[model samples]
Target: MTGLAPNVQLFPIESILDLVTDGVLAIDQRGYVLYANATAHQLLGRKELVGKNCGLPAAHGVGGTDLQLVRRGDMIWAQMRSLPIQWLEQAAYVITLTDITERKRAEENLRITAGVFDNSREAILITDSNNIIVDANPAFSHITGYSRLEVLGRNPSLLNSGRQDKQFYAEMWKTLNHQGAWRGEIWNRRKSGEVYAELLSISAIRDDSGNAQRYVAIFSDISYLKEHEAKLRHVAHYDALTGIPNRVLLADRIKQAIAHASRDRHKIAVCYLDLDGFKPINDSMGHETGDQVLIEVARRIEHSLRGGDTVARLGGDEFVVLLRLEKDHECLASLDRLLALISQPITLKGSSYKVGASIGVSIYPRDNGDADTLLRHADQAMYIAKQSGKNCFYIYDPLADLRIRSQNELFKSIRQALEHNQFEMHYQPKVHLRSKQLLGVEALIRWRHPTRGLLSPLEFLRPIENTELDILIGNWVIMTTLAQFDSWRRNGLEIEISINISAYHLESPGFAHNLRQQMALYDIPLGGLQIEVLETAALADIATVKNIIEQCRRFGVRFALDDFGTGYSSLSYLSRLPVDVLKIDQSFVKNMLEQQADKTIVQGIIALARAFDRQIVAEGVETEQQGEALLSMGCEIGQGYGIAKPMKAEQLQTWHQPAIEKTR
Candidate 1:
């Protein structure tokens, strides 16, 4: 009933063919030409096949059967299909020519896409809108141990192990439909019925009508990833070796604990514990053993702590204990009990170790609410505990810094000393008792602190050592000593200023350059400045010492061995060293008169000095008998409380008066 006649037709047939972009050809009952469309000739490559007879083989009108045609070096596909059509009151042949070039290209693309999906290391599956598996690649088959035929038409739930709840699935569906995609972890079962963890990603594909027609899922076995992630988590939040809460987790705990205490208006005790003599153990027993001991110690300390209290190792042999004892003095008792347990000796591997903990106690929300500051104060208190001997704890005394309160106030006072010239240098005059003349004025540092009055190095230097204020105080010492030498030269005094260099100064890489620069800054001669270094640290690093001493000596600056016999080195080191003068440590000088061995040692040193022809200055001589003893033994010089107790710089010029007049 399909009409193609010129008249009496209800509807036209071209309208139906127009719906298809493919080419259509019709033939008459005798196989004679009836009609042909433009695309059909183009598809056949003849371009003039209208009214052609259909008796020829179907391949003749087209390029060829199964033959590749090249246009611009591109393969084009031609397909022929014949159908029966009614036209002119008889059955006619309707041959359809479809230019499947694009379809073939698309097929090739789909094949490549399929190849990739099959070869992928990650499992890939495609499903219909209902989540029933329509296709699965080789990777999915390999991962789930299921063949393509076995999984196809089966829902993805076939692989579910029921590990995820219905709510999780609902959330996944909601997320996918709302966001067009979802990705997460899930537990799935293999064909062998074994369960495994997998990371999964699902995507919904919609048609032009905007309704989801298909879904794509990608997954991977995440068992190895889970193991690795767990390892990193431990390393991130807990110490790897000790398996205790690390600094990050401990700080977090402290912060959370402090916040809770603050809400309750309660006080929290934070104790910082540092193992005493732990360094010696680390050095002697090796780091492996040290780590074991720390783990054991962490366990013991945690065990000893009261329930609900947390003990976190802050790396090394340092630990922090958080006690949220808001009522009654429970924290103190708990801390004491834990500290006692920690003090017990630990036996590790084959060695028995005894290490005491020095604990610094700080109360949070009371002393301070901030976690970092509280930990710092606890650290300071720990040092105080160390000062009171080991195996003990100390509460942070706010008045600790007050002991040097006046000295701190003396910064301005010291500044005034610098400005109004209230500052002066004292000299403990070194006497050449053999030659019996003033040799040198060792510049002793004295701060005419206003509120604190005149303070010696002993009274203020310890504080300087424990703080950065040492640099300021050190600068004053250097500037004032150099100025004194300038004064002595102005008065025609030839004596050198013997200034001591702290290890902090000497080990400073810029020390030699800075000293030379300072000499140039003040226009003072380097020859008149004698830098005295204590023997202990001066010899500790021989290479560094050699480099520094050699570099400074090049500027015509000289060095004297101060506190000579105090170091642990043998005498063989002295004759070969770069030092210019040997000042016998006062400890050796004090016993020289009474101890025959001290006399022999001094005599040996003097004899050795005479052989090397080095200047020998005997220190700490209060008695003339000591001086005479040194002088008779061929010792040449002396400086100590014997002459004057480290006098001010102003006293040095007149100091030579008494000794010079005594000889004259």
Candidate 2:
């Protein structure tokens, strides 16, 4: 049997395919079926399959049925393989039969499955191990607003927004391959042309060998969240009050601008603008007006800047503008335009208040190397402008540094001026026109510096006015004047004393109260105390000014419209005021004889005062001619060197008695 000789061996083998569900039959030559199994006998009936043809009718039910016989016109197809072969030393044909009905049914099922795959609602894509797409689902077209024809061979990047960088995609791929799935927020685009944010999950599919063959990504629209987040960021960065980016955003943006300028070898300008005279409007008129003015200020700032610039609110009357300039000259031009825009008058309630702003501009890459340094430099420059009498702008320079030190010393000296009793006031008399009687003495402030002997209101008042030190000096002027008047009252000289009021001093909420309190404390009758308001102050927030005047009026404290006819507003408005005197400006009186216009203005003021039934006094009668001209113009009350020089409290009687004797 080892390596057996084929001639000597008598080997037999049963049919190896007989166990299959198909019928097996053996046919010899002459097409006679010689061997047939149970399946074949049952399939080709006629009692046997020994003489069946290959295309035989299936005969069953133990009769000439379609399963077992090739009956007349009965047709059936069967699996049959045939060849001429020797079974027992005979030339014969051997054929086999197989029942293939189950296989056909299975093929039909596969066709149905293929139909479902093609019509699926969810996007279905089939790809090879090389990621070459072979099939796609219907939902792909519906969701992407594109037809399958357009996306058949394309990758998923057809929806890419480029919002994510390469590393973002690289990481995504790494995670998806390492794990089985990865989900994330992604920015993508639609075929019809819009970008959208999507929640996307990509899954890796592998073969039985565990090698990744394809990727499946499912995504949905998250565009709404993107829009909502944008809105939230805007709300966070911009000011609700003014609609400009707030200080927080301004700082960050300026830092960014500075960085860009540094990189590009360029320069930027930073301007710090704080509205002057804004607090008075808010404190006296109410914050409602203040907010309106702030909004208006924002509008003006936006209108003033170049298109390449940015303006932001650093909260409360403080605004900062950034100008990315191509050249230093452009920055200068921008600053000039900004100043002109801010200088225009803003009107409210039929009353116009024109306030100038102090703008401190710092040019960068030159002034400083960083944002914080530049902002500080600009802020320091603004302080210089305010110190130099305000309503101006200053560039921060080395010279400005010296001026800053000088201003510091000046402020320190002024602080001492108040702490010590270096501040004093003297009074000038007002005469009654008809009786030529001493009506009142207008209080004028002076400073007796410890070393500077004496300084007029012009010299030291600027410093006091620039600071809130006006409040302190204002109190001194009021208290000391009343105390001196009470001393005169003790001396049995019954004369009214009028004290000048700064708009800043009067607008203080405690001003009227303090005045009445001091009057009570000094035992000085309010009638013997008239308050003088400059024409400049008379024009500030007339309603509030009127209220202060009225409040003092209730205390029997009279008011005088100091320097009448010099203001820009109508004198008729002053008629509504409860003032008791009108002092002709010295300039008008000085040129009254030389200028016919001055005569007409003086006469008109005299007539206006007569109509208002108020006492009129003319200041600066330095010569007999000036005094005679005023007297001729029906301005009997005149106070100047001609009447009496401003004298000390003790010298008042000596100075006034001579004038009294001359008039009598």
Candidate 3:
């Protein structure tokens, strides 16, 4: 009955072995399988594995060797261990198998992660909870110029460039504690003691309880980017030619200067300079020479100027100098130095050239001008300096510039009118005051403006006095007068013509020769043409005017001293020159009858003319009373609105016929 009990104790052993998921087997010392549990058969994928030798692997290696089980076209890794145990009352070995495929895979992933951490381009550093460096990757050593052996056990603060203060680190730690991470740009030093920029990101590794166990920092070197940014900044603010501040930078400096001046209650002078003769050299010698000259000039200016002053090139041959001064006169010394430097001989390519500068200074707040307006005023002043004389400096004068601008417009208009033949000669009749007979006509220039009808010489002539435009217009009047004289002579009107001549034109070296040539060309006799020269003009150089008059007399060309009574040397130079006519200035003639002083001056002028044996013609006689007064003073010839206001040539001819009949 007990033998037939179905081996109840063996069932308990089989049930205990089958309860485990891991494979369990009993093997004999000969390596033959004695007993196998269901888990073993299922894990091995073979039901016939038990009660067979199976040539199973033995646990004979140094550490319990691993065995491979083939199951349903898949291989399962197992860790096998054997130990001696009593199995079925026989000497046997207990074998245990544990599937370890997933554990192996997990270990492989950890190895890959470690490799990636070491091989990354970015540097990786690990620090303990106390902020001391614990480990560093190869890339960390390469980037920070420090080896792992050198960095381990040291604080990461060793790599600090000292660019960040304690406050910065404190803020960084505060951010790290609040956010568990911190990322930003930082400056660090390399092992070679060279500083570098880095983009660093740090993360705190926390344990399960959310407490930081270690700190991991990843950093990338960004020194190249920093250098590039510096280059961009330089290019933006510096001038290419002079290597100094450009307009963009100068604006910033000017702002600072204004602030400083405002605080100190001092004056700031803006000096605008233009080289006097740089253009001619640049055009003639080549741009290379010009560049060299500019370089030298910039160097000299920058060095000679006081510190804290800024000199900037506005481009081309223009430069702007900012000077802070305690007084207005303080600018003078700087200006003197600038002028001296510019005057120094510039030597280039074995050739020496002299250059000068014209500077214009505009004072701040005093002129009430802003930065741009100050520059504008300085430029205006510079032009004035150029006009007065080059190699000098000028202060901005608003009133003077206003007058200059107004006159400049007149000068330009006069030039344009001359070019367009907009000027005409109006002949005013000069008559014998007693007989009322027409003697001759004086030629007066009138501008026939296209827009504004006729304009008298008084309206435009004074602005161009003593300028090249005066000479040009004077020549024009002469040429046109001679041609009119020829036309009148052809028409049987034998009238002598008196033309006004400027002092500049009269004093020219070859005036006599040019007059002679023109008379011959026009086929006109010298007796019919007379030049009316101002007394002041003629006496400017008494010897020269006397010689010129004598030279003209040889050709029978007459000279008259126009505006005789207005000059101081009228009486003194009267005897020295052989002039035929004395045209009294209209100023005295027009007012002689009004004021007794004027009457005395007119009488004295007429007496002097007679004593000198020179014919006198009174001008600007507008009324019969003035003409009668001049006649009473022994002046016979007079021209005025009282005698047919400056008629055209044809109108003069028509009036002459009737006047001749009346005289007869």
C-alpha lDDT score of every prediction, in listed order: 0.76, 0.74, 0.84
Clashes of 3: 0
lDDT of each residue in 1-664, candidate 3, tens digit only:
0011124255665777777877777787777787777777876777576557756665553356677778888987888877887766767777777788778778789999898888999999999999999999999989888999998999999998999999999999999988999999999999999999999999999999999999999999999999999889888887788787788888788878888888889889999999989999999999988988888888888998788999998888888899989876689988998999899999887899988999998887677656877889999889988998999999997677679889998888888998899999999998999899877888999999988999999888878877888888888888888898899889888878888888777787788898888777796775888888877863467788888888888887788988887877877767787889988888887777778988898898888887878898998889999988888789998988888788887788888988899988
* Best model number under TM-score: 3
Which pairs, if any, clash in model 3?
Answer: none
Candidate 2 residue spans exceeding 4 A from truth: 1-408, 432-437, 659-664
Over the full model, what C-alpha lDDT does candidate 3 score relative to the true structure?
0.84
Lowest summed lDDT across 10 adjacent residues in model 1 is found at: 1-10
Where model 1 places Cα greater than 4 Å from the true spot, the runs are 1-41, 44-64, 80-98, 132-135, 141-172, 184-197, 264-267, 284-289, 348-351, 398-664
Model 3 stretches with alpha carbons more than 4 Å out: 1-137, 144-195, 199-219, 222-266, 270-307, 310-321, 329-362, 365-409, 449-454, 650-664
Q: Rank the candidates by lDDT, best first.
A: 3, 1, 2
Quick one: ranking by TM-score, best first? Answer: 3, 1, 2
